[model samples]
Target: MSLYTTTLLILDPDPYNSIDRLYRRVIQQAMHVTLPTGCLDIFVARPPTRFRETHFVVAQLYKISAELKQLENKEDIDVRVLLEGVGGFDIGDARNRSWEVVAVGKSDSKLLPVFIAEQHSSWFSPALQIIILPMERSIETSSRLPSLPSDEDGSHPPTEEGPHLGEAGLVIDSTDEEGGDLDDEGEEAQYPIVALGGTFDHLHDGHKILLTMAGFLTGESLIIGVTGEALLQNKKYKEYLEPFPQRCAAVLNFLAYIYPALHATTDEINDVYGQSVTIEAIDALVISGETRQGAKLVNQERTRRGFHALKVWEIGVVNGDANDQWAGKLSSTDLRKREFEKGELAKGQGTQQKLE
Candidate 1:
């Protein structure tokens, strides 16, 4: 089967209904058989006027994460989710203390693939060699493809009955013009400098989301604090931790790939505060919802230092397969443990083969 470096899928709002069957076919035909290098970017098309609930968007993201973890082949394909017609999803509560909206362009059918290919051409092939569409829309959509030659054409059949968005815990913010809630003046807030901290080991989709949000909010620079060995000593599978330099490089390389325009810098963080308290220029801090308390502590330190408190923004956790041992929030420690186990299993199999 021919392999594609980059592929695009235009999906509906409720993609969880068909995610399993859809990805199964995608992996079999379009993906690299041995080692996958590029990403499959899925743009979920929402009605231009309808408000996409933040919880529903997060649920779809976790559903994709869980499905990828369940695949036996485990080709390690990187999948990214983007919503159509919405710049970003604002997930904060009434006080807006939770998180800022991570901005993305409104999807244009004619320009989606072209824009992606142009931006990623430096790292991966520019052509979107495979285009996957819903079965109902495949025949009509095929006629609209750009001049690029496609290796394969694929479609997914319609899904069976599924729960309604509202029934599945969706909250509609009808007052806001877009996906996010507005300020008292009815305008979205923008920060010039944003900072976030993480281990960024084995950088995966979860890390990618956090980085993307921070970069999106940043108008001047995105400051990242990668945990140093001193801070990672107690982590599970610490034996497999990537060197500090490698971890920092991986985070910067990914930022360049996704947000080429973003001015980003990384620091080795031995302490939890990192540069968030030290740097007086930072306007906001982006963190995972699970790390809200950490953000609060950073603010306390900033206050103690006589600097103003930075705005706090939280991104929801991306979860892995619930049935497997790696289930729960997508974690780097779990990934390291998985690699160790795989190596051990290989060693045992090799010994048995030699004896036989």
Candidate 2:
């Protein structure tokens, strides 16, 4: 099969709720409609304000990609999760973020650009081939591209000279000849400081995946909020929870291993929001499914404090065993429970041997 690079823009509101179904659809589409193995850039356009929801979505996508690799026997499938800044979820923002994530230089020699969404939007470039899912129809045939805005004199602005159209219609130019520079042309625009918060206890596979994603999304630095001991006092399996300092150390170690070049800092958070709501430099916030509500609360606090809200990127819950009675994703609680059960079984076996 030919290698194809495609960027997918997901416009779903509750992507995590129907994760299994979404995964099936995505895999089916990838196998039948698009190339089975290539660079798949997935972007969730209107992610839930809650970090938990967003995290669930991301985790689901990660699981799906892994499953796809196993099923197709293609180990080289590159799947990247692209996140957008917090604000309006309009077509323009989605299109711009998509371009920003995939576009490297002025040329289109890398890969093919394809968009998949529930509905078609006019914000996409004319060169893009949009696929509307569930309906599974190409927007190129069903919808007409929107016309560019004209000046008061009814004349369209001159097209700025740039390099050849890239695979995903990425046009490279530092400055537009028509007037001012493009909004996303500066050095700072490429690398924005990002923040993420969690207890990060045990530092299992789930936490590792979340941290890995944060490292990827962050351009310059990653500010992590490890919940203080006081805040986690009421948590389940609190006795087994690692100390705040140890948790912080584990997080730092994991980040250093995955992203040796990234500048990562960890702080103790006593409250829910932490530095994400207070820090004005943070551009986005990475969250998992359990902390979704916390993200919304953080945004609310930011609004009250007259600070810009941080864009929240949610990751999905890692699925547990299929035969397990609990019908939810894998969690620290689950891990702890298994440990407790194993201890109890060991004790029972020792008692039986003594009696014998």
Off by over 4 Å in 1: 10-38, 43-62, 65-69, 81-132, 136-187, 320-327, 353-356
Best TM-score among the predictions, by candidate number: 1
Candidate 2 residue-wise lDDT at 327: 56
Per-residue alpha-carbon lDDT of candidate 1 for residues 111-192, written as tens digits (9 for 90 to 100): 4444454445444333233243223222122222112121333112222432233322222122233222221211335578
> Model 1: what TM-score?
0.64
Per-model TM-score, in order, reads: 0.64, 0.48
**Best candidate, lDDT-wise?**
1
lDDT of each: 0.54, 0.54
lDDT by residue for model 2 over 1-356, one digit each (tens)? 33345544343424313445434455445534334555565545445443323444556556666676667776455555444333222333334433322221112112223232412355454445444435222112221112223467533343232111111111113333332222221222223798888888866656766786666567788999988967886888677777788999998876663355678899999999788877887887766656656777877787778887666655444654224632555467766676778888999999999999
- Candidate 1 Cα deviation (angstroms), residue 50: 13
